[model samples]
Target: LLGRFFEARAKGRASQAITRLLELGAKQARLLRQGTQVMVDPLELVPGDTVIILPGEKIPADGVIDAGATSIDQSMLTGESHAVDRGPGDEVYAGTVNQQGRLEVKVTGVGPNTALARIARLVEEAQATKAPVQGLADRISAVFVPVVIVISLGVLATWWIATGDFADSLSNAVAVLIIACPCALGLATPTAIMVGSGRGAELGVLFKGADVFERAKEIDTVVFDKTGTLTRGAMTLTGLDSEADERLFLARVASLEAGSEHPVGKAVALGAEERDIELAPVAGFQAWRGLGATGIVDGVEVAAGRARFMADRGLHIPDRYLEALETFERRGHTAFLAGWGGEVRGTLAVADTMRESAPAAVAELRRIGIETAMITGDSRQTAEVIAAQAGIATVLAEVLPEGKATELARLDAAGRSVAFVGDGINDAPALAAADLGMAVGSGTDVAKEAGDVVLMSGDPMSAVVALRLARATFRTIKENLFWAFAYNTAAIPLAALGFLDPMIAAGAMAISSLSVVTNSLRLRRFH
Candidate 1:
């Protein structure tokens, strides 16, 4: 009976030890994984191949949509819940998803500069790029392990040489080494960054890495891209003539523009769809690119294009409608008037309108004391119009595609920490040049690759949320630094004076690192 009891006790101890070993292995594995290691190889992706994506699956790389129209749920890359419709020529980001459609996309970016590659680069860069000032914790950790080793050796040697206490010295040395781990110090940064990045991802904000997070905290000025950044980027039918049976005129115009690829044509078609109008097929179809289209509708030669198109046809477009057209054009709208047999019938106003959230987002930034500015290729009048609507005080209009980088440099030279928010092919150079570059959802992969942070919602308003998260993260870093530095300052002197044992110093080091990690974990609770 005694033998059986002893055997059972031994088995229990063995099981407990095995469990502990497994747990320790898991912890180490997790630490290694979070240690800023790159896992995916760039060469794994093939160029010019069709990348297939199913519903709810993240796009593994950057690609151009080759076929199929689907509602993409890009909330993982863009914070909005509205499933955006995508077709051929549209670029999809690496981490976005096909919400309800199966898209066969042609891989465009295959190597390090691909959207996914950019994401990886951003994350690594953020981690490697430390804040301007080192945290107190990291400085302490720098000297911590070495000092602990020296003091432990001295304690062991002094005890054995002075009192011949070999066992006592060993015990004291082991205790000191065991307790003085810099686990808290190490945890401080990775934990906070992981938490912040993860939370931002959930909210549709992708922080490339730590540097962006750190720099974002210090941003005093925000520059916006006009078209897709602040606006809906979709043309809408703002107004129409109701006095002349505008329904028939709109339907006739829609029929004329049915095959045209101009943005204004598409907007007219969408407006007609909303009104549930069935447009009759038109004949003698002709397109005047950059102007409009014309056709024979209901036996009448109906032409829908710029006011000049009507005037050229000898149609006397009334001064009243012309004035309205001028006003809409000044506000960044494209005006189209419809006419039959050279007599002006009606006018349709179309414009890419600003988002409902834009003005409110600007107000929120103002509330936080961040100055807002606008940068665009739009004419001065149009830029001023949008600026006024959004309550922005500074406006830089008529900026060409390549001019954005120069503007960013100018701002940098002026000593302002500028953050640029934009979407589109033209915004790539500026996105790369800004102190902090933000890419909105649905932009080109190149733009996403160039940005420090990608806003999945594609809404500029999310920039405000990002700024808040960054500030909070910076504060956590400061706290951790203080704890790390203070521990070394107090414990090192005590150890040198022979008052503090090696075991105590080790314990202090461990506590500092652990505390940093715990503080970082707290960021997970931030909304």
Candidate 2:
């Protein structure tokens, strides 16, 4: 009964941690039916149903906004402290709180299909899985039981032959068996893995299996994908130069790009709108495949695209504008030259911004003695610029999607245990090939499936935190194992020598298991 009580307590502690995450979902949902709001259970929500979420209310299902807009606090799911703006056609997940404004969301997923449910399932699976060290413990326990039985038999025979007393010999043999039950050995690695993995979930890190804790602690070098991992994936206007009227030049360029669907063109158009500049109507708009786009704006021919595109259109770029283009390109920005009536008038520099936590994340890794490197398909100049901004020393430039795994192999050949951090479909191979793979939460599903650890926060600093947590968890596992082995090695002989009563032996065995469990519970206090 005492043994069962300790086992139940250890299991209950792990279950409670998982329950906290599962309880984040809102119990009820407000649905819109024929223009009327109806209260319904979250589980009753189905696809195609429009749900109404007001301020200070939790979103009850994963869906797209059908009407209205609001700022949503996604800290519960993504660990981002700030509220993100959600408008028409924006995706919202269950468990996120609506900050302000009314939103009508078209429910796309609910119940087990929701993102929150998937996260809880992953945590449960990780806790249920066993670590590699547990297999060793199992083997030892298997051998230990029989060896202890033999010792107990020997004690019984020696006592009975020396004193001609069977009852006393039997009592000593039973005491030896009771004390050397190997309960502590059985509880050591698994309890630590359960508590450690549960703690990881609370920190926005999800370990795919118990074995990930072992692999993560062995990482000495961390390789990062440049785009969408260390840097924001979206392009933004960073620098603009014009020899003519700045607003007029921007209006003409933005007018020409307003018809395009390319990322750079959208950034240029958005920049003009943010400044409240009015764009003239464009006519005869033509886009060249690899070059820039040109159109007639307000009776003048305006073009916005690459330098080659400007030169192809017989436009002359002044020395000052050319120098500005070089300055922007050298700093990893993609420069667009805008020309009107055969003369280049302005230059636009667009680039992906680095994450706020990237520099500090790299510094933290270095401070902990882990080397950091960056790999990307970008040009050497562009890759180097971003690497320097993130404080990473080694840069692998112009690496194709297929070649990323090869670069990881090269690192492995150099005796480095590498962990790859990536957030795109192209990174799936590299993620799987590394010693440990960390996938950003905002990344593609394929990348997350390949990763051993998922960074739900999507912050570079979370990767550092994941590594620290893994190391701490593994350390706890080792400590538990050591104590279990030491306790058994010291206590078995005392029982065999008749120095311990059977009742005392049983109590000691139960305490040994409880101690291992209590040691693992300390991980719940980890930051």
Sum up the clashes in candidate 1.
26
**What's the CA RMSD of model 1 in angstroms?**
12.0
Q: What's the TM-score of each model vs. the native?
A: 0.62, 0.84
Best by TM-score: 2
The digit string of per-residue lDDT tens for model 2 on 1-527 reads 66556666776797676686578888899989998999999999899999999899999999999888899988777656888898999989888899999999999989888877787788888888999989999999989999999999999999899889899889999999999888888888888888887888777788899999999999999999887789877787889999799989889899989898765788888899999999889899998643679899999999887676798889998888888888887898867789888899988988998998999999999999899999986656777888999999899986767788999999999999999999635478999999998988751131246689999877899899899989998998899889989998899888878899899998898889889999999999988
- TM value for model 1: 0.62
Q: Write the per-residue lDDT of candidate 1 for residues 193-293, one digit (tens) a residue.
A: 65576566556567776767778988988999887788877877887863467788888888887767655678888899999998888899998644556
Q: In the order shown, what is each candidate's alpha-carbon RMSD?
A: 12.0, 4.8
**TM match of model 2 to true structure:** 0.84
Q: Go through the candidates in order and give each one's C-alpha lDDT.
A: 0.68, 0.86
